[model samples]
Target chain A: MIHNLPPGLIMILGALLLPLLGQRLSAWGALVLSSLSLFAFWTTPDFHTVTLNLFGQDLSIVRIDRWSWIFGLVFHLAAITASIYALHVKDTKQHVAGMIYAGSAIAACCAGDLITLFVCWELTAVSSVFLIWANGTETAYRSGMRYLIIQVTSGVLLLSGAIIHFQQTGSLVFENFLGLEPGQRGAISDLGFGPLLILIAFGIKGAFPLLHNWLQDSYPNGTATGTVFLSAFTTKLAIYSLARGFAGLEELIWIGCAMTLFPIVFAVIENDLRRVLAYSLNNQLGFMVVGIGIGTELALNGTAAHAFCHIIYKSLLFMSMGAVLVRVGTTKATELGGLHKSMPFTTVFCMIGGGAIAGFPLLSGFVSKSMIISAAGHEQMFAVWIVLLIASAGVMEHSGIKIPFFAFFAHDSGKRVKEAPWNMLTAMAIASFCCIAIGVYYQPLYDMLPFETHYEPYTAAHVIMQLQLLLFAALAFVFLMKANLYPAEIRSTNLDTDWVYRRLLPRLFAYIGKLVRLVDSLFRVACLAMIKRFLNWLSKSCSAQGWLGSTWSTSSMAFWAAVLLGVFLILYYL
Target chain B: MKTKDDNSKGGNSSSDASWLERNVNVVIAGLVIACIGSLIAQLWWAPLFAEKHVEASHVEASHDDGTHDETSHDEHAHGESSHDGASHLHPAEFAVEEVFGFEAMFGFAAFVAVVFLGTGLRLVIMRDEDYYDS
Candidate 1:
């Protein structure tokens, strides 16, 4: 509202001015602009809305409430840190794209109406693709293409759903589709067709189970710095959208459970450390989705809180990997080892990020993730609680133990590289600081929740259990290492759901094309053979020397004439 | 690979190996201590940490106590984790969450199982680095 415009639009429009700032200074310009937008967002009064009447319908362009505020503030933080991280890059396009993408996501969360949300949603898709393409690899470009298609398809679904929703409800206000208030439970059956489509739209963006391949597919393909940006906004925005629109939807619990469970296994075999982080990202999102599904005040608070903390720590993890990628030219676990010998600071940062993700005590993940698990326990969903517990152990296995263990401390690949750039280090340090700060002093974060909560994260039982879970998981790693039961880090591509499109479906279509060609060739060959046989017979029959066309007809006629005369003579004698 | 690694541009070209690499045993020892410490901590904190006797805790509690030898909590100053009549599927005086080393063992077992599953998963899903491209 600094210029009586949406805070996100401010960053988006201000991004235009960034190119004028020149390549060298544009990154700093972005940092400044996001900070400005954050300040403007901070000053916005609670529940403020800017509605525009458009063609007989009210289009709410901007709305600032508790939900958007928290998301917006975190988006701003991400933008500033990402901008700082990208300061070493002279590419103006990445900066511009980064700002616009982050801005649109912020705008999308703040959007009061579905139309506005849809516009920003598409903007996020269009703008963010450049980050992947900036890698300048064929793999990255193709991955970006797939990413754009899926994201644009999500946007299309959102728009179509919005139009239908308007027809049915005569309002495009983004609210609970089931018309349930926060903390009120509802079933998926209660939703209209529009809401279901909208849920899918959110689900695609949210990386919901089967719809999740794009996240693991594209994120690892992005530029080193760009993946850090990619990790922060898109899925969390979907989590926010789902929380706003589909909270308490009963089916989300199972979907979230599935979302959490599979990624850890995929992460285990994944050779690309970046892809491992991507899978880990999906797994983390599952916890937030489950929180939103539970639809209790504490659970919702957990979702919001987890989202906030996740953006920082996940960004930190990605940043650390990006550092590795920048220095060593690969984040392949097989190629990366004994990095602590050279890049000790980077190694430390990576471990901190890993520890944060694994929900070590007094780390950001611990404080935030527990809320969701406790909510599950509070609901007494024993199976779900147990699954979540297993997932936690899985998280420890992959992100906590494997990422740090293999990347920094395992057998010496003997690659000696410098520490990350000052700007990158600063960004990681800032994010790391935020992780610890939030973990220790969480009340301020708790205050930003949409609902009131006295949910405590530091209970004696909770801490001990979490410690036991994590520490023993670490011990298991040691045991596995000692017994040589741990899987060796091998250079390989691990199959995931993306196999459907990237491999299976494309191969299916290719086979289909081959089958069509096979059939067509066989038919043509058979027809030609038949035609040749017919012509040969026709030629044989029409030839002058052939029996049918020859003078043998005359001989047969003479014999018939003699026989007829003999018969006549006989008749006369009788 | 070694040739590529030889391009050590900056930051401690002097050190051939890190202290961590030299003292891997020390790190492992620390982890072992932490694991043992966590189990010991559970035993100590079980009394003060016992929360409500959540109804569902009994099911897992009873199952856990079935392997009573593995579970480290026999000295139940509080009743929640006690194996006597309290560990039955019936409503316990305390929650099953207080079961000493239960989470620890579960975490250890689950981690091993997940890693083994991952190793097995490699048989089905792992492919050459350019599997998709090829």
Candidate 2:
């Protein structure tokens, strides 16, 4: 244990120090320092807890454990890669904000207590919004606000749940609490609202089915590099927390399946490639969530390994898309075509990413994705196995082929653009290398899993079977393309399940508003008419309304008080 | 409001586009053949290229016993003996329940295929210079 040196505090201090130096140097410096810190503890023993005093109690801020390290390692890699990609960006606010955002996530992973996690969680929320605002567009501003509200609300749930958990369990350890002891469970349920609050907290960040609007709304609108970083840490952190807390919860399996399949439909018709990726990102998280729900040693390992591979491949895909957006001033598939001649390198990198995401044999996705598939078969979850298999094919269609095919290799749109910058290319190369390295040398990764198991990812039969699936999926794509049996991208919107909330709910509110206004106006008119009639009658009865609308006399007040007192006495007696 | 593409007159007009349209199939087929052929070749020549090694080979075999209930003391010790043939309802398999649904899954796959095919046809039907524009 170290004194006066928690990782969160160190990160907060670094965030303050960044803008003081030159923009490029400070951003690079922060990335290097954070990477070094991560390296320092990469192989540290699991379950290493470090404490700090907060509010007169000992609080654990650094929970060095297998899970935290798993997330921490990837977060650092993302930050470094993002930093390298953003070397040309001149926005100081975005740079500083990105560091703080990345730092808070790292700190959140290391946070051993609920309060510490909450602090870092909200910090990430506040800091990352600047990245969206840095886009300097009206769309980005609105989307940033939406992103902020949702994120802060998720943080609020965390705080509320932490309080309830503390009151019940009398401790605030941020580790697994899905299945508590009987005494704790009794206390938890007695609070009545504990699980509900915690679920909502994880739900928003986890992007659980219908609760996943903020992601599609904000991600595409985020600045190019901002989206790259956004792709990496935030949602994946929610997934990690879910795994830590809600594993083996059966409800999550169906949610995961829905997540995997639903997005591909929208992504296929979606004009914006970045938004397509957001949908694709949602689909990928479903797999991890499924693994967590399985909660077996193999399933959990699958979740972790998937997260690891997903980070690199997803970021690479994002980077490639970002390059297109930067050069062509758009990522709309309809508007993009045949840039493979000019941007050959970008195209190659994108194909690698697409293949990886599609779970093609020998790609990063295949090895990790199979774990979830096999887990389903092992459990005899016939429905789930079918869905996952369908999702695998959907991935091939949308991300696997559509992304690269439309942006780089359709009919030549005659747009001549230079390749991505040296730094950007370097970053892509590193990420692509990691993707292949992980795919090809999966044994080392399997060995590093928390579970003690011997799993063979490569065999003649397994490879042959995987090839059959992928080859057949590719054939499907070819047949579909040849036959014109796909949905065309239209200028109009394709409604998602979010339509119930985003469009339908708002329209409902407006309809209610109109009705309320109509009723209120009618009531006001009736009230005025009634008052006029009463006044007219009073005027006739009392001559110029002497006792009413005119000056009130002490006699009138006394008379009313006498009547009120008599009525009060009568009621009391009854 | 579909505009007629003047390029329907064929490749004689524009050198760049004609060159690409003429060679696109050849290039794509070449790439496909190359990627597959290389991967197949790697089976013998590229040991380091394969994603899995020997240790991971046994993981599927042992996964059943290793994942016996955490609450069941010595339950894992019984191994394959305790596992009944009929009821394979292990807790670890619960994760995919949310991840897989029949109608939704099949629907998404079919939808993606249709969308890709539709877009590709759209490109052919209403070819435009600025199809990539926002």
* Strongest candidate by TM-score: 1
Deviation in Å, model 1, residue A274 alpha carbon: 0.8
lDDT of 1 by residue, A501-542 (tens): 888898999999999999999999999999999988888887
Those runs of model 2 whose alpha carbons end farther than 4 Å from true positions after fitting are A1-11, A43-46, A180-192, A497-502, A537-574, B1-14, B17-21, B27-134
Instruction: Single out the weakest 10-residue window by summed lDDT for candidate 2 chain A.
Output: A180-189
**Which candidate achieves the best lDDT against the true structure?**
1
Report the error of model 2 at residue B129, Å: 20
The reply for model 1, stretches above 4 Å from the true place, is A1-3, A546-548, A551-574, B2-15, B54-95
Candidate DockQ values, in order, are 0.27, 0.09
Best by DockQ: 1
